[model samples]
Target: MEENIRRNKIVGSRRFSNYFWTIFLFIGGFSFLLAGLSTYLKINLLPFANPTQLAFIPQGLVMIFYGTLSLSFSIYILLTLFWDIGSGYNEYNKLENLVKIVRKGFPGKNREILLTYPLNSIKSIGIKISEGLNPKRIVYLCLKDERKIPLTPVQQPNSISILEEEASDLAKFLDLKLENL
Candidate 1:
């Protein structure tokens, strides 16, 4: 997914494929769960169902266990999707002189937790690149107190130019130092 940079804020939405997998899992899990429930209820929807079958009880028990597990996983995925998990935003409020980072979480009355820092506390913004089999690139805001707060999500195949541009933009907007690393 791409990041949207405005004059005062940056928002990063989760990738489409991420949502697709969650939906896929939710549906598949529910189907498996339903099959298990059918077996447990002794209500055979299949044409091969025979009331006199000796294995029905054992089959039902196994199905119930499998179905419960699948259904539980599917439910977790569904709830996280609704909660907009993994989507986050960083905002710069000029008038208030505050920088805010909002991270979305599980569904609730208010599922977001907002962290605010004074504008003066921000020291610099830099890109962190870790290269290996599973490479990662993240932009972090370095604070005066030596705390590094990640500004962007873990990016795959992180290009130095892109991270540099984003970090510089943020650094400039906040009137802070830019560290290219």
Candidate 2:
């Protein structure tokens, strides 16, 4: 058996209208909604105002609430995008019998969840089953014992049967128990 195997990498699509575009779209929709509401009422609520100086307390409160919520959500989206793109790392291979997986740094390496031990760590693997354009289905190689190493692969166009095969193969390779579900 091979002791170490270099990983074959998979790169996500590089599209202009990906995460950045989505965040922009979210901000656009939020602005449109707020502007439409203000236009319908014919009021200038572009900026926040003190409660006592406001004309209508309820209306002002609603505007402030929605504005805060929208801004917070937009910021969250930005952070998520940055984390995904800036700190993202792809699996080197479909399956690799390695002691550890290390993430280097941005544009070169990133953070990694690794599988350090060959045996006596895994508890069970749960495969997601679904249908859609972008379904969230993958095998989570969970460990029941101590946290020796933590590694999970996020597979696309995922199917349970396929993940089952993969998990079974891995289980046998590691001589670990195969609890398919």
**TM-score of every candidate:** 0.69, 0.49
The true-versus-predicted C-alpha distance at residue 128 of model 1, in Å, is: 1.0
Top of the candidates by lDDT: 1
Q: Model 1: per-residue lDDT, tens digit, 82-168?
A: 655767777777667778888876667777778888888988887777788877788887889989988776435558778778778
Best by TM-score: 1
Q: Candidate 2 has which clashing residue pairs, if any?
A: 7-92, 8-92, 8-93, 105-109
Candidate 1 segments whose C-alpha is farther than 4 A from its true place: 1-15, 34-64, 86-88, 107-110, 154-158
- Candidate 2 matches the true fold with a TM-score of 0.49
lDDT of 2: 0.48
Model 2: number of backbone collisions:
4
**Global CA lDDT computed for model 1:** 0.67
- What lDDT score is found at residue 152 in candidate 1? 77
